[model samples]
Target: MSPAATRTDRLPYSHSSRETKDADDHAACLSNWQQRYDQLSAGSFSGVFEEFCFGNVQLFREGLNQSVHQSGIAWPGSRTFAVPVAIEGTGWFGGEVYDAHSMLTLGGSDELDFRTPRRLEILACTADARALCDYAQQVDHRNIEAELAARSIAPASPEQVTALGKLLATMMASLRATPALLHHAQMRKAMEQALFATLLDTLASATTASASPASCRTRQLVVAQARAYMEAHIDEPITVADLCIELGVSRRTLQYSFQDVLNLNPVKFLRAIRLNAVRRALKSADANGRETVADIAARWGFWHLSHFAAEYKAMFDELPSETLKRRI
Candidate 1:
């Protein structure tokens, strides 16, 4: 029984016997780790893959004070997966501390660093994944989902843990909720199956009508690429036609993907992005009063002052001038 981790091509169905032994230094902290993992160890299943929607949950490792992410993707289609899974046991890193609410996203092939001096538990995700992929062609959700998955290694969210704790408490209180229990492998089976079924359905139906997920109208991989391009060239003028050429798809195809995946046409997407940049600038601009709404708006590509103001107000519920006016 050691704190050491065993790697595998897939989850080992019999890992419960792997026993977690601790160094004398970490042994005192075992109860903390045990308590945290036990709180969220739903169930396990036999499979090469398993998934779960984190209702609300969180965890803090044996002996850490703050969670610090190691290295991970924060954007969608960045190869960071958006699958949901369980949180269990002590992690491989020293004192795997985590927050009960850091908006975590989980995927394979990534490592996370967490630090919380006390025990922690967390879960985020809801029962309503809501028709997984029914709107995959919509670019917005896919983008956000991709980004969420990439950022999953960051931390758990309080909202998430609350949901998870409530779910488990209601349905699993009698089964086991102790850090000292030998193992709840049998109990974990149902949870694991649910996760597997969810993953299979979601990943399979990720795109509205792509022959497969990889080829969806707005393949998450491709939209992620487009977002990156837009971010890099925020100051430059980008057109839908340009994006179509860059993505190697026709204009209609691009529009269709964005429409389905994000519920937005390209122009709207670009405007929203530009407005965001303007808001950022306006927030930091001094009313020592050097910046003007028109100045910032035009710079961010919003040339028509009246039009930009209307759009900005609609999106952010505030006017650019209002933000600047507050400074006065």
Candidate 2:
């Protein structure tokens, strides 16, 4: 079945607000991007997205109530910047731990890798690439072409980050209270310029940091390679020993790599990934109903039915059968 439609209201430019109970549904709420969200923490998943756009610029606030691993390619030909306004625990963006002081930048079809904590709220802005660069050159009197290409997770001052978050939040609140404000051409133009100027100023104030230690970088690479291998052979029965041998690392090294990079052991992380995969398959099952819960579970290498069901329900707060029954 097709995904549930997002609730959107027509405005002078465009404004949308969506709340979703399903992770993938939340992933689909963002326009002009390919994204997939895997629920990591237990219990039910909830997400909120509020977006406003004028001309070539877009600003939005997104919140998730559960820990999730989000990976996707963001809007093509656009430069996107994200600031974490709140976080329940540790979060990662593009392999680096991020906090409220961090600003994540993505340019021109860059891949997105974010592992967010529960109750995470982010304020983000996306603008047409050429327009943003031109604006920076004309107003900021600076060339940001190289910086955008690098797309680093630069550190901005906490005050600047907080101010930017507040600006976006206040704008969203105002728009929600007075949707007709979007009809005011001068108001829209002023808001748009304010957003671009604030974001560019935040970027300008960011400072570069020293590189990560070689050992840490190596572990990150190992984890990335291992994850790719697991996804490629998800249907096969693979073990830690297999990963150790394949990656030419000791068992301790593999263990440390997973822990350091994802705060998860290899085994548990792999299982969670497979479980999410099974859930997605069940949700997207055909109307003909050719697959059973057990059939789908086995396809993802879960041969023990009872054990799988218990773990699935524990993670999602719903039985596999219930999920299949909801399939459209």
Candidate 3:
């Protein structure tokens, strides 16, 4: 059989399930996730709901609530990887806590055994190994599979970890807000390349000691503290001075720390985080147009409607109203 010619005009397949309320609902939501594997199961019962699949990868932002779960993923000898962008609550994966820094293997025969009493929010990126290698070859003629296989859960640099999280969040938001992008072949392929490149770069540089371990750990702690503060007070107004006081660091120290980790100052990072939060609130709001964009922005600390709209568009490639209206 010959390969079919690529169809530029074909619509990209998009699937999203409503919120799951029971075991049957959860199974329906996770049907696609299990289809890629040969065997899968869950220990305890809870809810699972999500929108999955984009381009050559499956992008999942899952809302999970359960006591324990286990699955055997067999991708039929294909090389593939899964990145857990952000993990909330606590669980165990391979005898270690499955936190924000962990990556899951989706191909081959791998097992996922985890237990947690609380709910979890997880974003995962799963892609084909061959496609990733082809993308890596364009950048550097190295053995991409060798680099990927070097570590099941590659320890990424702090900045790389943060970047990957942002990439997943951005992709999820974009797919939901602008589903038309899925139909754009060139755009989807470009995004797939972008994802693979980030994975390759992060995985390949796992062992390079460009920075001292102590310094790296310290910087990660600082960034984590700052993020925690921002997330805790997301609805309250925050300033650089406020962060400095709350984090027990000077203004210059805080500025330099954020620059090193996020490549953006503290203020910009807060804005970006708030932008994402606002976008989420808009998407999850009532579809009957009962909620206003201004209300959502204000909830996320954006009081200036005009300024918020511009920054929202710049960050998400769409107006705030557009995101809300799309839900309807």
Using all chains and alpha carbons, the TM-scores for the candidates as numbered come to 0.32, 0.58, 0.53
Roughly what TM-score does model 2 have, to 2 decimal places?
0.58
lDDT at 158, model 3 = 61
Sequence-dependent TM-score of model 1:
0.32
Candidate 1, 1-328: lDDT as tens digits: 1111222323222212112222222222221122121112222211121112111111111222222223321112112222122333333222333333333444323343333222223322222222222222232224334533444343334454444445433322222222211122322332332332333333333243353333573455566777888888876555554465566654345656677677787668876776787787888888686667766664554433565689989988988788877663
Clashing residue pairs in candidate 2 (N, C-alpha, C atoms within 3 angstroms) = none
The weakest ten consecutive residues by lDDT in model 2 span 1-10
Taking the tens digit of each residue's C-alpha lDDT, what string does model 3 give over 40-72? 234454555565455556666666555435444
Per-candidate Cα lDDT values, in order, are 0.40, 0.73, 0.59
Residue 192 shift from truth in candidate 2, angstroms: 1.4
lDDT of 3 at 251: 41
Can you rank all candidates by lDDT, best first? Answer: 2, 3, 1
The alpha-carbon lDDT assigned to residue 23 of candidate 2 equals: 96
Superior candidate under lDDT, 1 versus 2: 2
